[model samples]
Target: MTQDATAVAAAKVAGVVRELTARVMQYDATRDRRAVFAYTYFRLTSDLAANLRTNTLSFREPEWVADLSVTLAAAYSTAMDAIDSWLGLGAARPDGAPGGEVRAADMPESIPKPWRDVYAASTVRHSYVLEEVLFSMMAHMSYDLPLALRALDPAAHGDLRRHIADFHRMNDLLASSVDGVQDEISARYCRRLHSLDRLFTRDDELFTSYGIRVARGMAWFNCHRLLDPDAAAEAQGSISRSTAAFIAEFRSPDDWKRRHAFRVLRALVPSRRQWPPAGTPPA
Candidate 1:
């Protein structure tokens, strides 16, 4: 892509990030559990957009990365827009229908399954914040990512190996974002996450970072499968099955022990005395 084209792509990412930030703020004001994931996503995308603007990572194919980011962001925004329309949240409908309303009966078939699950879980007050974040991550990384990669068609770009390298380079940003993301989650939702982080030996970070790395690796592998004529259907089916299984584990009643432990920790840790002002930029 030409320099002008890269600039255009970067500008598109910035616009999407701004829109997402507004959505996140709306969710927070409503005390919606969806805010947990929305905030995390806002931070990640903001960081990516900032990097793209500054050429901070010096990505080999910066335009491709910017375009991929925009693609994934669009998918997420589309799903959210559908859900918002269904729930009467006042967002403009994607279909341009009057009053931004979607019929309840049409909602289930309209939204992607993983996102459907995420929205359902968000309505449950007892759902774990971390699990909600993971649900969003899994939906985007495991389900949306391969499709984005396939759509971009790296082979058609240039230097396939360089594209792959740039992809793995994202893991570094993910790893670095872990602590700040956890801090934001704690500030916004659960005060006791710090204690739990200690109880888990900071393995929470290890688990999250490692899980994201593995998920991205699988996404890359699945992208290859998606590009293959014989394997695309099977690969997509496998993605759906695995994502469903992940959501199921988080929803199971058998996880009471962990929930009980969290309750205990909540009792032990003092609540945050002060929250960052609304619209404060994430660290």
Candidate 2:
């Protein structure tokens, strides 16, 4: 097929896949949902960033891929930071009150370091590949919950589309901004894109050939908005144990080792003094 025809076909297939993805979400019996909503928010943001990255350039350009990688890295970093900040706050406020903080000991015991590492290292300086992988996992969860809500409720689906589209339309351009001074970064990005496009596009094509794209469209409708924040939290809390189990039982060592940035200073800082002996705030 010609390039233009191919693009159109790809888009159409993606849309069908999105709809199907929404459909599959209807079957999630396990209530744990935080990761799902998180994925929806993160990817919707990623999609928005991707659009901005490619707004002026055609995908055929080698430069287009580089610009996108730089863009993805930066966007993912900022998004990850935002998520961490929020999660930090949530852990600190279990009773909905302030003052108490997220204790390190409170961290889930079985949590995979890779998952947490992905969380810790998610910075805009990196590309979207990691973000894509992380979100893909969440997308699996999203596929089951809010998506089902959309199918059963038109208002739910309509609201979701509108919200996601709006967020995607407006967000900070960290990657582009970072490239403002580093002129050669785009060149590096393009080279990486050439390699990655082959991988992602290949998977996309295989899914398409198998008629799966008509069901799980990567760049299509993205209708996960039917899930509200409350639902997501309740779902997350419910699944913490199961998620913990999956991490310990299924994660590979490669996954854990692939993501740590050497923190030269993090370990050097003085430790907190035993929480000041319970209630003694004495000087």
**Pairs of residues at least 3 apart in sequence or in different chains that clash in candidate 1:** none
lDDT of model number 2: 0.31
What is residue 63's positional error in candidate 2, in angstroms? 35
Off by over 4 Å in 1: 1-9, 89-107, 154-162, 196-207, 251-283
Q: Write the per-residue lDDT of candidate 1 for residues 111-168, one digit (tens) a residue.
A: 7777776655444334455656777788888888888888888563423445887787
TM-score (all chains, Cα) for each model = 0.76, 0.24
How many clashes does the backbone of model 2 have? Answer: 15
Query: All models: lDDT?
Result: 0.68, 0.31
| Model 2 spans > 4 angstroms off | 1-84, 87-145, 148-190, 196-283
C-alpha positional error of residue 192 in candidate 2 after TM-score superposition, expressed in Å:
1.2
